[model samples]
Target chain A: DTAVSQTPKYLVTQMGNDKSIKCEQNLGHDTMYWYKQDSKKFLKIMFSYNNKELIINETVPNRFSPKSPDKAHLNLHINSLELGDSAVYFCASSQDWGQQGTQYFGPGTRLLVL
Target chain B: QQQVKQSPQSLIVQKGGISIINCAYENTAFDYFPWYQQFPGKGPALLIAIRPDVSEKKEGRFTISFNKSAKQFSLHIMDSQPGDSATYFCAASGRTGANNLFFGTGTRLTVIP
Candidate 1:
C-alpha cells in the first residue's frame, strides 16, 4: 500500500489561476508536513501540522494556505498563483509529534505556472 | 541563510568506485542529521541518519561519518553501482518536537559503468 499519496502528479496552469493539491497518509502518523523543492533541487519546509493543528509556518506568502481536515489528510491551496509558484510540492508524515521519527514522503505533485 | 551546506553540487563516479558527499552545519542546536536519496519523479527517502553521539554509522555500503566538533558530516558510498545514481540531500533538525528539517542543496550523483 502507498503510505503517502498525493493528487495531480502534474499540474500545468496559467498565471493567476488558483489550484489545490491534496495529500493523504495511511501510516497513522500524527504529524504531517509540506515541503517545496525548487528547480535547483533545494528543499525547504513550508508548513507542518500535528494532529490537524498547525505547528510550523515558515516565510511562505499568504497566497499559499494549508488545511488539514484530519490526521490523515493535508491539502494545499494556492491563490493568485504566480510564476514563482512553479515547483514540486511534497507531503511527509512521521509517527508522532515529539519524537524524532523518520518521515515518509509521497510522490510529489509537480506544478508549473506559465 | 542556508543552515546546512553541501559540497559537489554534482558528481560522476565509475562503478566499483567510492562516492563521497560532504555537508556542514553551523547550528549547534542541531542534533539529528539525516541523508535522503531522491530519484527522478519521486520524493526524497531517508537513506541513513546519524546523531551527535555517534562518530560513524554504517548500513551495508552506505556509511555516515559525523564530526561533532567540526560540525561536519559525510556520506561515503562504497562500491557504488549504476543503480545508486540519484540526488542525495543532507538535512538537520534541532530539538523541535515536530522535526522541522532544514535541507541542504542536493548532490546529484551519476554512477557510470
Candidate 2:
C-alpha cells in the first residue's frame, strides 16, 4: 500500500484559473506538510499541519491556502494562479513534529500555469 | 536565507566507484540532517539521516559522515550501481516549535555501468 498518495498527477490551467490538489496519508501520522519544488529542484516548505492545526506557514503568498480536514488528509488550493505557480507540489506526513520523526512523501503533482 | 548548501550540483560515476555528495549548514540550531533520494516523476524518499551527536552512520552501501564542529555532512555511496542514479537532496531542521526543514538545492548522481 502506498503510504502517501496525491491526486491529479498533472495539472495545466490558465493564468487566472484556480485549482486544488489533494493529499492523503495512511501512516496515521499527526503532522502533514506541503512542499513546493521549483524548476531548479529547490524544495521549499509551504505549510504544515499538526493534527489538523496550522503550525508552520512560510513566506508563501495568500493565493495558496492549505486545509486539513483531519489527521489523514491535507489539501492545497491555489487561487488566481499565476505563471510563478508552475512547479511540483509534494505532500508529506510524519508521526510527529521535530527531528525525531521521519517524513514520507507522496509522488507529487506537477502544476503548470500558462 | 539558504540554511543548507550542497555541492556538485551534478555528478557522474562509474560502476563500483564511490559517489560522494557534500553539504554544509549555516544554522547552528539545526540538530537533524537527512539525505533524500528522488527518481524522475516521483517524490523524494529518505535514504539516511544523522544527528549532531553522531559522527558517522552507515546502512548497507550508503553512509553518512557528519562533522559537528564544521557543521558539514556528506553522503557516500559505495560501489555505486546504475540503479542508484537519482537526484539527492540534503536537508536540515532545528528543534524549534515549527521544526520545518530547510533543503539544499539538490545533486543529480548518474552511475554509468
Candidate 3:
C-alpha cells in the first residue's frame, strides 16, 4: 500500500485558473505538509497542518491555500494561478515532524500554468 | 539566503565507490537533520537522518555525519551501487513546535558501473 498518495499526477492550466490538488496518507499521522519544488529543484515548504489545523504558513503568496479536512487528508488550492506557479507540488506526512519518524511523500503533482 | 547550503550540486562516481554529499545550516535552532533520496518524476523519500546530539549515524549503506558546533552535516553512501543513483537532499528542522523542514537545493549523484 502506498503510504502517501496524490491525485492528478499532471495538471496543465491557464493563468487566472483555480485548481486543487488532493493528498491522502494512510499512516494515521497527525501532521501533513505541502512543499513546492521549483525549476531549480529547491524544495520549499508552503504550508503544514497538524490535526486539521494550520500550523506553519511560509512566505507563500496568499493565493495558495492549504486545507486539511482531517488528519488523514490535506489538500492544496491555488487561485488565479500565474506563470510562476508551474512546478511540482509534493504532499508529505509524518508522525510528529520530528526526529523520531520520517516524512512519507507522495508521487507529486506537476502543475503548469500558461 | 539559502538557510541550508549543499555542495557539489552534481556528482559522478564509479560503482563500488563511496559517494558523499555535504550540507551546512545557518540556524542554530535546527536540531534535526535528515537526508532524502528522489528519483525522476517522484517525490523524495527519507533515506537517513541524524540529530545534533550525535556525531554520526549509520543505517544500512547510508550514513549521516553531523557536526554541531560547525553547523555542518554530510551523507555518505558506502560501496555505492548503480542502483543507488538518485538525487539527494539535506534538510534541517527546529527543536520545538511543528518543526517544518528547511531543505537544501539538492545533489544529483550518478553511479557508473
Candidate 4:
C-alpha cells in the first residue's frame, strides 16, 4: 500500500488559470504538509496542517492555499497561476511537525505554467 | 530559518567506495534526524534515522553518525553501487506526537562503477 499518494501527477496550465492538487495518506498520521520543489530541485515548505487544523503558514503568496477536509487528506489550490508558479508539489505526512517522526511523501505533482 | 544545512550539493563515488553526506542543525530541540532517498521521478523515502542520544546507528550498508554537542550528523553508505545513486535528503524534527519536518537542500549522489 502507498503510504502517501498525490493526484494529477503532471499538471500543465496557462497563465491566469486556477487548479488544484490532491493528496492522501494511509498511515493514519495526524499531520500533513505541502512542499514546493523548484526547477533547481530545492524543496521548501508552503503549508502545514495537523488534525484538520492549519498549523504552519509560510510566506507564500495569497494565490496559494491549502485546505484539509480531514486528517487523511490535504489539498492545495493555486489561484491565477503565474510563470513562477511552475514547480513540483509534494505532499507529506508525519505523526506531528514538532515531534520526531519520519515523514512519508507522495509521488510529487509536476506543474508547469506557460 | 532553514533549520537544517546539508553540504556537497552533489557527490560521485566509485563502486565499493564509501559515500558520505553531512548535515547540521541549529535547534537543540530537534531530537530525531532522518535520511531520505529519492530516485528520479519519485518521492523521497525514509532510509534510516538516529536520535540525539545515540552516537551512531547502522542498518545494512547505511549508517548514521551523530554528535550531540556539535549538533552535526552524517550518512555513510558503504559498498556503494550504481543502484544506490539517488538524491539524498537530511531532515530534522521533534514533537511528542505530530510530524512537521525541517528539510535540508538535497544531496545528489552518483555511484560510478
Candidate 5:
C-alpha cells in the first residue's frame, strides 16, 4: 500500500485561478506536512499539522492555505494563484513531530500557472 | 539565508566508482541530519541519516560521514551503480513543535555505465 498519496498528479491553470491539492497518508501517522519544490529543485516546508492542529507555518504568503481535516488528511488550497505558484507540491507524514521521526513523502503534484 | 549549503550542483560518475556529495550547516541547534534521494518525477525519500554524536553511519553502499566540530557532513556512495543515479539532498532539523527541515539546494548525481 502507498503510505502517502496525492491527487491530481499534474495541474495547469491560468493566473488568478484557484486550485486545491489533496493529500492522504495511511501510515497511521499523527503529523502531516506540505512542502513546495521550486523549479531549481529547492524543497521547503509550507505548513505542518499534528493531530489536526497547525504546528508550523512558514513565511509562505496568505494565498497558500493548508487545512487538515484529521490526522490522515491534509489539503492545500491556493487562492488567486500567481505565476510564481508553479512548482511541485509534496505531501509527507511522520509518526509524530520528533527529531528522529522518519517522514514519508508522496509522489507529488506538479502545478503550472500561466 | 540557506541554513544548509551543498556543493557541486551536479555530478557525473562512472559505474563502479565512488560518488561523494558534501554539505555544510551553520546551525548548532540542528541535531538530526538526513540525506534524501529523489528520482525524476518523484518526491525525495530518506536514504540515510546521521546525528551529531556519530562520526559515520553506513548502510549497504551508502554511507554518511558527519563532523560536528566542522559542522559538515557528506554522503559517499561506494561502487555506485547506474540505478543509484538521482538527486540527493542534505537536510538538517532541530527538535521543535514542527521539527521543520532545512534542505540544501540538491546535488544531481548521474552514474554512467
Candidate 6:
C-alpha cells in the first residue's frame, strides 16, 4: 500500500489560474508537511500541520494556503498562480513533530504555470 | 540564506568504488541530520540519519559520518553499484519538536558498472 499518496501527479495551467493539490497518508502520523522543490533541486518547507493544527509556515507568499481536514489529509491551494509557482510540490508525514522521527514522502505533484 | 551547504553537485564513480558526499551547516542549533535518496519522478526517501551525539552510523553499504564540532557531515557509500545511482540530499533540523527541516541543494551520484 502507498503510505503517502497525492492527487494530480502533473498539473499544467495558465498564469492567473488557481489549483489545489491533495495529499493523504495512511501511516497514521500526526505531523504532515508540504514542501516545494525548485528546478535547482532545492527542497524548501512551505507549511506543516500537526494533528490538523498549523505549526510551521515558511516565508511563502500568501497566495499559497494549506488546509488539513484531519491528521490523515493535507491539501494545498494556490491562488492566482504565477510563473514562479511552477515546481514540484511534495507532501510528507511523520509519526510526531519531533526531529527524531523520519518523514515519509509522497511521489509529488508537478505544477507548471505558463 | 542557504543554511546547509553540500559539495560536488554531481559525482561519477565506477562499480565497487566508494562515493562520498559532504555537507556543512551553519546552524549550531541543528541536532538531527539526515540523508535522503531520490530517483527520477519520485520524492526523496530517508536513507540514513545521525544525531549530534553519534559520530558515525552504518546501515548495510550506506554510512553517515558526522562531526559535531565542525558542524559537518558526510555520506559514504561502499562498493557503489549502478542501482545506487540517484540524487542524494542532506538535511538538518533544529529544535526538538519543530518539524521544519533545512535541506541542501542535492548531489547526483552516478555509479557506472
In order of listing, the candidates' clash counts read 0, 0, 0, 13, 0, 0
Off by over 4 Å in 5: none
Tens-digit lDDT string for candidate 4 (B1-113): 67999988999999999999999999987888999999999998899999987899999999999999999999999999999999999998775434567778999999998
RMSD of each: 1.0, 1.1, 1.4, 1.8, 1.0, 1.1
Cα lDDT, model 6, residue B60: 100
Give per-residue CA lDDT, model 6, range B1-113, as digits (tens).
89999988999999999999999999998988999999999999999999989899999999999999888999999999999999999999987556678899999999999
DockQ (CA atoms), all models: 0.81, 0.75, 0.69, 0.61, 0.77, 0.76
What lDDT score goes with residue A27 in model 3?
95
The residue pairs found clashing in candidate 1 are none
Candidate 3: chain B TM-score against the reference chain B: 0.97
Worst 10 residues of 3 chain A by lDDT: A50-59
**Per-residue lDDT of model 5, residues B1-113, tens digit only:** 79999988999999999999999999898999999999999999999999888899999999999999999999999999999999999999998667678899999999999
Ranking by lDDT: 1, 6, 2, 5, 3, 4
List runs of model 4 lying over 4 Å from the truth: A96-98, B96-98
What DockQ class does candidate 3 belong to?
medium
Question: What does the lDDT come to for candidate 3?
Answer: 0.90
TM accuracy, model 4? 0.93
Ranking of models by DockQ? 1, 5, 6, 2, 3, 4
lDDT of 5 by residue, A54-101 (tens): 755547999988888877899999999999999999999888766456
* Candidate 1 vs 4: which has more TM-score: 1
How well is each residue in B1-113 modelled by candidate 2, as lDDT tens digits? 78899989999999999999999998898999989999999999999999989899999999999999998999999999999999999999989865587899999999999
What range of 10 consecutive residues in model 2 chain A has the weakest lDDT sum? A49-58
Q: A1-114, model 6: which lDDT tens digit per residue?
A: 999999999999999999999999999888899999999989999887886357655579999998888789999999999999999999999888764568999999999999
Candidate 2's displacement at residue B91, Å, is 0.6
Kindly provide the TM-score of model 3 when superposed on the true structure, using C-alpha atoms: 0.96
Give the runs in model 2 whose Cα sits over 4 Å from its true position.
Answer: none
User: Model 2, A8-76: lDDT tens per residue?
Assistant: 899999999989999999998888899999999999999877863576555899999988888899999
TM-score: model 5, chain A? 0.93
